[model samples]
Target chain A: MTDKKMDIIRALKRAGNNPISGEELGGILGISRTMVWKYMKALGEEGYVIRSSPGSGHVLVSAPDKLYPSEIMDGLDTSIIGGDIRYFDEVDSTNDVAKKMGSSSDEGTVVIAEMQDSGRGRKGGHWMSPRGGVWMSVILKPNVVPAYAPRFTLMAGVAVAKAIRGLGVEASLKWPNDVLIGDKKVCGILTEMDAECDQINFVIIGIGINVNVLIEELSEDLRSSSTSLSEIKGEELDRIAFVQALLRALEDEYIRSKTSGFDSILEEWRSLSSTIGRDVDVVTPQRIIRGKAVGITENGTLLVETAEGLEEIVAGSCIHG
Target chain B: MTDKKMDIIRALKRAGNNPISGEELGGILGISRTMVWKYMKALGEEGYVIRSSPGSGHVLVSAPDKLYPSEIMDGLDTSIIGGDIRYFDEVDSTNDVAKKMGSSSDEGTVVIAEMQDSGRGRKGGHWMSPRGGVWMSVILKPNVVPAYAPRFTLMAGVAVAKAIRGLGVEASLKWPNDVLIGDKKVCGILTEMDAECDQINFVIIGIGINVNVLIEELSEDLRSSSTSLSEIKGEELDRIAFVQALLRALEDEYIRSKTSGFDSILEEWRSLSSTIGRDVDVVTPQRIIRGKAVGITENGTLLVETAEGLEEIVAGSCIHG
Candidate 1:
């Protein structure tokens, strides 16, 4: 950990139940009081809410930047997820950063970014995230083989759905991988893994959400098929608070998933899935299958009742009607 | 095309069974005769055998650099596949460069390098290519679904094996994706694609070969198992010629696999396979199946005939006895 991260931790600890003097805090961090004020301002810019006083000190009344490390540190109660956060102003991609950190960083470590210049989606598609979006990539060192790793994608879908519902938004999952609001997509999860034959080195789950982005600002194609939290609610919701809820939900779901298996996760996913029982078309290179969406297996495959009988689709683009 | 490339093409054309004059060649390229001498020297360093004289220009006798775009171009008889070449001294990873170029470059352009700072293998393992190895990434715009993109790995494996054997090297293929020399891996292929649910934007095939690598300088584990062409032949082979051969073979195999089907390729793979009809242990995430390596399927899966039953292994590390 760098000295900057430590100072942020110390500041949060010192402000437990009360405000800490900025001058005194600056002295502890071995910087000038003005520098301390600048650090506080930086934290505030990142979403930390430190109430300022003229002579007393700085009070951390509420976590305005809930996803910021300082705000998430003492507030986050999860065991592993978000335990160590590496926040970047701009990066090629959070997934790329997480991947580079995977061998060295512990499991459940998360990398969050304000914006990505090279954000990636499934199959290497460009994920367009300008700013004011929830873009994060989490590193998971699961003790599973590469084939079974796809189940993590399904697990994350369930977690995202639950987190969105917690905010009173009606979000549903589509088969294979998609989170939709009504008929439009609100979020997309990309799960990339590095694995040998039977062993998995690490997996990076990159989740992109439309948080406070304006609909008009989206690309022409995305504008018609995507929805934002602010757009749906007709107001800008607290990003920090939403991310906190999401990380907490993700941690819980991930634990349940690895230990208890995908039964409950699949059930949760099914309930929130809009693709189930819908007429759909799936195209693979070998053949195209059109059928009624029946269910999802534990391996995260979609079971469709096609003309040839029941078939499982490990991956495909889904169009629901 | 740049003037340099065009000048070389014109010089080769003008040679016409007789060497062109240096003064005339310099005039054509709009460079001084001294500059022409320098270019010839650079071309010589790149492994082009140019017959030169005091007044005579130069005659192309042979190519030197294996991964030179001109070599691949000469070998390719297609409209695409080797249209453009981007050579790098060193890169973080070729897949990354290919991904960046994937959206902009033509469908079949290729990126070649002698080394990489962060060369990647399947599952994030280090593809250690100190020097004297083939490290290349080809940009391909294959209009297919993402699920079928894994086929590119299998297809590339066949290409690598075919190209190596065309050089009379005893190269065989391992299950799902690996080109092996005897019992050790000599090459690895990584296929990354960008796609929507049903449509693929592009795919990058990052290939690494242990050609001309000194096995003695390798790590203990690799030193004991791995073998290289130079080590086997006890001499340095022309890399440019080898690259040309490999690209030619790859272009042919790619076309066959994508257009005709995997049946012909599977047959070729089976003939070159050393694992089939042998005792092997196949490890997957769900379970371990130990049995006779009976055969490989059209989809590049290993068919293991165990005491329990015959099983199909999609992806796994294979141990053969």
Candidate 2:
């Protein structure tokens, strides 16, 4: 059903300013002219503006600002990632939905929502996910143990950081899970998974990017620490293009993780690290380790040089000291 | 409702052979004599055999083999681990139910079912969980990264091995997550969790042990590799007592993990390990490492000494060579 709709969209997009008649579309798709008109009406209902004239036929105008599956298909590249994209107008969380689909869905399946009613952050924190933000989760079935999860987290951080940096703005990665623009966070990555001790069943890499969202949408307590792309750029940016680049970058890093042992991705993360080489306080559950971030271990753990010498922190919340 | 039932059960058990009057039970519970009679009737409905006489009161005869939450509480010794025990006659999987209860239920909440229609094993294998088997999941909210999950897996393994050895049969642990009796399998521990990259929200340790179940209950393919406690001991052991001991052992190991850096648990695992000092083929996601198992790393990773020298295998399925 959507193949024909995609054909019509592609045909219209290829024609540029020139109008393509329903008769031409029917001939191209081997369908009747009435079916072509029906597809056009469906596209119109989806907020795709179409201009129809008597002699010139129909001209494609503009598309909605929503992240519809068909709309994401416009500029989306990659073979598997986002290939089976599921879009929702609203959801409790994309990660929750992705976890449900984990057992059945193929690797790289994507779940996205325009607004999340109860989006989650790291450490049981809440993530504000109003409209105009990129609230999505990518399903990955990596063949590794739970201990190797840090590589995936670093892979996502690098991918999100690269996508944000592609917009000509300097975006750095905070160790473990946050993407920051200077001192404030513009994006966050929450990677959740279901795994046995030695093997992962599936991993849902939830990437929440505040694209074209108002800064006021965040809770008052987090307003100072969070910023959006529109707030930084002083204008709304095209979300469709940004999401395409982000998925592509993520796919690149994911391929690298499997192909090159994630060493390149780890190096990229090191180069863009906002935590390393800085005075920081890592608050682990067992104890607080205050030191200068010295380096990253081979397993993606943070090595900090404390008064007791170098200590490796496996998991913690980091605050700039 | 359950408190009253438990109080009545305790009263009957405390009486032992002496029949306590309904009047005496009511006085202890601060309820009417009629309420005490009703409680006895309820216990009778739950497969509890009771004997009533004219002058004397009700005498508890025998309790059913069912792992009711009330039954578990009788011999349970753990302060936190089994504080909230959930029991079902049947379920898809105890792990599935435990994951749902993990968010709201307190740490160490235990979920058990007599039969699982879809019991899951490690690496997407199926576990036959018919009646007369111990199918359960323990919810653990550990303050550690997913990398440290191996410790919990090892902890559950040592606890399970201890419980099985308590049955007068030697049970040893395999690297990663399997329990064995001699050369065949007796128990398996599957550790699953929901976590962000840096921290774990919850870990569900699913343990499946065959007690009174028959050896023929397993699929034909698994029959040669699997055995039951009843088959080994030539008698059906008391499950309620076994589960109490298992939960107590698990709670002890869990407390030790927090007090110690899991070095002690690792040592216990090493002592009970059937994989250590054995020539083995470790099948990992990336490649296979064939070597003699030398020792365990401090992080519970298997150290294999191959021809290339000592190798640290973080995650793998070990097969004895």
Cα lDDT, all candidates? 0.77, 0.87
Output the number of the DockQ-best candidate. 2
Candidate 1 on A58-154: residue-level lDDT in tens? 7776554334555555467888888888888788889877866776788889899878899987777788886788889988888775556667777
How does model 1 score by TM-score?
A: 0.77
Q: Write the per-residue lDDT of candidate 2 for residues B1-321, one digit (tens) a residue.
A: 289988888889989999999899999999998888888898899898989997888898998789988878886778879999998899999988887677778998999999999999877778889899999999999877777777788999999999898878999989878899987888888888877766788899999998888988778998898888899999999999999999999999999988886888888899999999999999977799999999987666888999999999887778998
CAPRI verdict (incorrect, acceptable, medium, high) for model 2: medium
Taking chain B only, the TM-score of every model is 0.85, 0.95
Which residue pairs in candidate 1 have backbone atoms (N, alpha carbon, C) closer than 3 angstroms, thus clashing? A47-A65, A123-B193, A123-B194, A194-B123, A195-B123, A317-B197, B47-B64, B65-B240, B66-B239, B66-B240
Residue B149, model 1: Cα distance from true site in angstroms: 5.8
Maximum-lDDT candidate: 2
Report the lDDT tens digits of candidate 2 across residue range A1-321.
Answer: 288887888888889899988898899999998999899999899888989887668889987888877777777879879889998999999998898778789999999999999899877778999999999999999877676766777898899999989999899989778999989998988888877766788899999998988888778988999888899999999998899999999999998888887778888899999898999999977789999997887577899999999999877888976
DockQ of each: 0.15, 0.50
User: What is the two-chain DockQ of model 1?
Assistant: 0.15
Could you give the CAPRI-style class of model 1? Answer: incorrect
Best candidate, TM-score-wise?
2
Query: Which portions of model 2 show Cα errors greater than 4 Å?
Result: A1-62, A273-298, A302-321, B1-64, B273-294, B303-321
